[model samples]
Target: MKLPDPPTEKSFPSPLHHPRTATMIGRWLGIAVVICFLTGLFSHFQQQTPSWLDIPTRPASLYRVTQGLHVLTGTVSVPLLLAKLWTVYPKLFAKLPWPPSRKALGTVLERLSILVLVAAMALELFIGFLNTLQWYPWPFPFKETHYALAWIIIGALLVHLAVKLPLITAHWRATPADRTPIATHPESLPPAITGLTRRGLFRTVVGAGTLVGIASIGQSVPAFGPIAVLAPRRPNVGPQGLPVNRTAKDAGVTAVDADWRFTVQGPQELSYSLEELRALPQSRSNLPIACVEGWSQGARWEGIRVRDLLELCGAPKGARLRVVSMEKGGFYATSELPPQFASDPLTLLALKLNGDDLDLDHGFPARIIAPNRPGVLQTKWVHRLEVLA
Candidate 1:
């Protein structure tokens, strides 16, 4: 049987499929992407801190805020992305100019970049949202793949921006299509079938982005919890009134043995039984447990300071430290603390959380609670510390 002719651009004649609409939606999507990228970079460095990087320990909730924004922007980008795709959908059916002129060759490259951008962004948003739910149905390692996909998406996005910059500039501001009365302005006129104007489409897309943001932001902002119908986590709903991504059971940790001893190896060695740990001069920090999964909550943590512990172990000032956790099978069972974090007065070997002993899932015996650190790097169920510098 013969195949029917492919659909042409004229087949989709919704007036909202014009350049101005695409530019408007693209602007919003672009902003969200930039914010998401920068926040993600901060989180990456916080988790895998390099010796050259010196992250501050003040603003104890810095990680919480940045990570919350990361998830928020990623969530908001979904609707904007869909709207942008819809605005430009008709272009996919357009015929490129024949004879391979320079302009036609440029069109081919632009469309190719756009295709890569859409595919990568679409997949990126899909996996990113699922990650917040702590789900990984895909076979690939989520962290590394997610990290790499971000760079690819950003590069593709830059190429897309470069290709579309002229069109974007032309329609960047209000024109007859945006401002003229719809009754008289043919450019903003409703189509014979769709009965929708450009502004109407803009309003609908903006409303979608706003609603999705409101619904998903509760995972990060407790005040929005009741309205966060789409949120995967309630910030205060998990063990010890905070969400836990990895549980003691999941980490193959059942309980702390009575013979458990916390140790530190440096210029001089020191060890403490759990009771001895409690007897040390205690300090309290009001901090938040901010995980990469986008849930966070403030809690009062009482514990010995890492700097104090280092001093007791005869560690020199400004030394790097390694925190070792008893967690059985996972990355982040042991994490490094750069000198800045190790020397922070607020960085703690926390024994108590929210005025009570830590629940097993929250890391019993001792865990690291450092300012401006990712929850995974909090190093739960910590048993030993080694001075590295």
Candidate 2:
């Protein structure tokens, strides 16, 4: 008897499995991806600023806005990614080309790129959202893994765009073919009942993205604080009227005694008691403490100008500083303040926040508060400022 023919899979009909739909969703997703990538890059550099970069101290709220956008774009992308995946889910079941041809190899490679893109992006978004919540159950280091995966995702996305350029171009101005109401499908409820169409589906996807954004953005935008129920932090609800990322207790800090002193060692080593620091000419800055986790608050900070301290200690003009903190065993025990930041009049060893003495939880005694710097680099409970040329 002749060998039986192999079974063939039948195509499932759905109103969403159209190129027009995928293109529409993909465009929105692309915009989100670009925004997240650029803002994330800015945040990374703010944390690890290079010697050549002269990040400005003006506007003061620049870091706050960029970091906030980073988190917002990342969060909104979640819904867009899912909806894009669903629109093209049928493609996942497509069979590989047989008989080992060159065309088949190309097809396989394209599919492999898509796999990498999907996996990396999905994991990046998941880890990023978890990071905001201060939950880390993953074995890998969150920062390194997140950074590496970003490059991989971008690479895969570029490859995907190149491969689908023709399709994208064709659909860019093509009339909306799937304009038929979603109710026409046999399984779908009638338009009279569901009142949804392909256009409506697109609107619904955008709406989902907006809803998630609104619910979580209150962490960064104090105006929406009451509705930021889904956010991990309320910008105004924390120790000393600001959200605290790493507390003194968590940093293994014990109660500082009367012997505590703030020192600035340069060409001339100088030390001051808390009272002496208060006696020094104090300047005030309206600055925002912006964290990488997307929470920030504007505060009135009172402190001695970093420039004045440098001059008082007889440090060379435009000298860099190594800010050392009492907190133990972390990468941020000491942070380098570039010459520009060290000399900026706005840069301060803040002693008071919101007109009150610095709360230990908010970097008691003294803390570094420089413009356009990541909160992590704002060394808390500072005890020493070693002029590092």
Candidate 3:
């Protein structure tokens, strides 16, 4: 049997490049980009400002998450941006009188602004991704470069939009969603399905899926991959050999039916209390708890890395990890580290702080101590570990 004929060029117009869709996407992306830029700037100021200015101590984990989101959105925007640019490319080369008339000058300025915006977007996304992967190629700090470029990009975008006001207005007037289909054939496409049509649905679905993939995989997946594979063993160094604060009665936080109880759970499984967790291989480290907040402290951390604990429990790889407090309402904070951190010697399910038994306020019983990361991501008072696949 023969397969159905492929869609004809005439039957399927180049695929609708809906002005409404483009505008909506661009507007939302523009807002997101602005937010990313502002947050980055604020984070920088928080670090640089003197104490007299009384800036709040920004948490290291907060910066990591915001920065992560910023980079993720920027990377995801790459394709959407390219598509928008292609859809508008025809206007770039449209015939114009060469004598520098007002219209010609205006068009020239708009195009130049677009060129700069595109270039800036490319540079920022590329550098941001590298930074996340722990690669810094340029002499300038990534934060500095990113901050400077952000202003330029935003300024150019504003100018470009202002100059294109007339065209944007015309497009809006021509294709209000209530009056017309949401998408139409690409100018390059054959004349079939002339007005906004079902093709728009396809683009929307594809674009939404792409956005989800970028957000989820870019931010969460890599960090949650199998811990054993990435961080096979604990790091030799820990919080600078800080003295343990615990009493002789609770060495290694092994005491049962006390202020602390270790909680370990595999993905989709019941959790174990502190005594149960002590049965696993034991490791200890003294490392620095560095914070992006401009404060650094050293402490000795003891316990198994969450990775080893999870592996012992037969937990699946790349699960969303959560740590809860043992207190009432289980008041807790969370940090999502890649599985690699789990196996790293520096990554500890710490039961002690400053060489003492776990402090109640400082995540007593058990907390996570991850090297080269902010304290907030450390998740203190760990009463539960929920593995989300």
Across 1-389, the per-residue lDDT of candidate 2 in tens digits comes to: 99975433225466667778889999999999998899898888877777776788776788899999999999999999999998888788788899889999999999999999999999999999999998999999999999889999999999999999999888776464556665545776776576456787888999999999999999889999889977999989987789898899988787888988888889998999999999999999888889999988888899999999999989998899999999988988899998889999999999999999999999998999988888999899999999988
TM-score of each: 0.94, 0.94, 0.49
Predictions ranked by TM-score, top down? Answer: 2, 1, 3
- Worst lDDT window (10 residues) for model 3? 228-237
Question: What tens-digit string does per-residue lDDT give for candidate 1 at 1-389?
Answer: 99998899987755677899999899899999999999999998887767687799878899999999999999999999999998889899999889899999999988888888888899999999999877899999998888898999999998888877899999999776664223323475454343566777788889999999999888888999888899998988987898898899999999789999999999998988999999999999888999898888888999999999999888888899999999997888899998888988899999999999999999997899988888889999999999998
Instruction: State the RMSD for candidate 3.
Output: 16.8
Q: What are the per-residue Cα lDDT tens digits for candidate 3 across 63-94?
A: 44554455446555666566566555545545
- For model 3, the local distance difference test gives 0.56
Given candidate 1, what's the lDDT at residue 184?
A: 26
Between 2 and 3, whose TM-score is larger? Answer: 2
- Candidates' C-alpha lDDT: 0.89, 0.89, 0.56
